[model samples]
Target: MSLNPIPNQIILLLLESYNLGANINLAILMSLIWNDLFLLFLSVRNIIVFFGPSPTLTKPLRL
Candidate 1:
């Protein structure tokens, strides 16, 4: 199956990072790292919102 555009772009970035190898500059590397982290944060937030909280995680404490 084909990936949607967001995932496809992320994959392309990963491949580009690999291809750059040891010659890659620090600024490009930092940008890639931050972009990936931001994407990960957004994905996790979307998943949590879509599913809501788990029952076990929301269980009330006993007195």
Candidate 2:
């Protein structure tokens, strides 16, 4: 299985933001973070649907 690089990309963004004399574009940074989180949410939802709710932490009852 290939490793997800989302966290790596985020870490790189944070490192770049801390660089001396960095441009620090908040709009682009915030958009990237928001995009990643939205995608992660969608994937997690899909997994729950695939596996059924009983295996999840909340363990919602299955119909």
Candidate 3:
């Protein structure tokens, strides 16, 4: 749940004039998304380019 607080602060400002709790929640969401998307994109890229698309990376296909 760690990101450059500047963007979060700016979004919070745009959303509600800046609130601490929402800021923290956004940070958590950003981290979670990064962790999930990182592996997902990596696996998909590998499968598409190198492995020619298989069922291995399709298990997490929630898109």
For 29-48, candidate 2 gives per-residue lDDT tens digits of 88899999999999999998
Candidate 1 Cα deviation (angstroms), residue 43: 0.5
| Candidate number achieving the greatest lDDT relative to the actual structure | 1
User: Order of all candidates by lDDT, from best down to worst?
Assistant: 1, 3, 2
Whole-model lDDT per candidate: 0.87, 0.82, 0.84
In model 2, the clashing pairs are none
For every candidate, C-alpha RMSD to the true structure in Å: 16.5, 16.9, 15.4
Candidate 3 residue lDDT tens string, 1-63:
789999988887877844676889899999999999999999889877986656866678667
Better of 1 and 2 by TM-score: 1
**TM-score of each predicted structure versus truth:** 0.54, 0.48, 0.45
Worst 10 residues of 1 by lDDT: 19-28
Backbone clashes in model 3: 0
* Model 1 TM: 0.54
| Highest TM-score against the true fold, candidate | 1
